[model samples]
Target: MNALLQQLQDKQLIWLANQTEAPYEHCQSTGFPALDQLLGGGWPQHNVVELQSHGACAELQLISKALNHSGSELLQVWINPPAHLCAEYLLQQKRPLHQLIQLNTHRAADALWAAELCLKSGCCIDVLLWQNSLQLTQLKRLQLAAAQGQSQLYLFRPLQTGQQLLPWTLSLQLMPASTGLQIRILKRKGGWQQQDLLLPWAELYPQFIKPELQQRHSSYPPLSRVS
Candidate 1:
């Protein structure tokens, strides 16, 4: 044990104590192996993942996958999902409704506050903030709160502009592919490789399919949104 500690100290002297054998918490997966491969094993428990997309549906699918993957296990998921933002679709994903903390805040500032409060608590491991109407101050405050909590954050913002400015551990911009969607890792940390990967729609939701089923769906859903 001493030797192991000594080696870890030598390799990660600055973070040795913090990283020392603390039960190896599994990261929350986005339910796509290809995308999970892009973001190391999965999205780290204590980091921010930026989902900069042009539309709302893409971000919704990604966030739902993460929530379903974690699902009453190692971490709980809290989402500031306003009423106008398609809550029925989220429930239709078939994840546990009870485990989800659904907040109904219309104002962007209120939503940001709820998100920050959820993050600050160590109880919640993952949070998804749907920010289609957030201002500059709201974004900065959310960023600061996320940083302070040291918890995993998924910020979904609709940015139809040229590009996005990323300030998180991982930045993913997903585009429409011929059949499915193309996910690109615009920013990353650690040993993550592969800037771009093709993630099929079928791959994102494996639970909906029967485990013993051999056939695969032939048609892809109509391309309604891209980010």
Candidate 2:
């Protein structure tokens, strides 16, 4: 009888090992090779990623490539975006405008509510939310909801908020640079990266800057030359 019980336990362990998926297998590429290396392949699915930056533009640039590469069937929802998203810009980047949805609200509470609902609904595979501040408790709630919906949740907050310990699958800080954006990984599931990566802003969106701005900033060194 003891031998029979041991055999059953061994079989169960083997079955569990076969059913579990490797962590890297669940990641989706961020479209930037350097960024992918830092993230251990790509962004983890069914997790909440927090991006803090001075302006929403930097965060948008970071994820623009991923959005453009995403499938047409996957909906990308934006909640309380900082500024008006130009349709022409998205189209030029090869992002399907039809798959993009935006929900605007002035109140923070309303914005949070809408974002949580969208994450829990499972109607969208990717959800982007921009808000002023959120308590750790509130963030945890959203994190659980995101896990349940199996959605990729991105929360954008102002850099002024500083750093705080929170339950996030990944967290990053975006600093504007003359060449592009400097990304610092604050927290990640498996490990932490101390070094910062400079991703050329122009690589993600060629037409983002106006002709006048480009001419004025042309003297600045390019991203590759930085550091």
What's each prediction's TM-score? 0.62, 0.75
Colliding pairs, model 2 = none
Among these predicted structures, which one has the highest TM-score? 2
Question: lDDT score, residue 181, model 2?
Answer: 79
Error of 2 at 1 (Å): 34
lDDT for each residue of candidate 1 in 1-227, tens digit (9 for 90 to 100): 99988888788654633343322144676666776666666766665667767663355676666666553543454465544544566568665556666667767677777787877776665687767754546556666665676566787766446554444456677787655677777766444357578766556545564545626654777577654
In each prediction, how many residue pairs overlap at the backbone (N, C-alpha, C within less than 3 A)? 2, 0
The runs of at least 3 residues in candidate 2 whose Cα sits more than 4 Å from the true structure, single-residue gaps closed, are 1-25, 205-227
- Number of backbone clashes in candidate 2: 0
Q: In lDDT terms, how accurate is model 1?
A: 0.63
RMSD of 1: 8.8
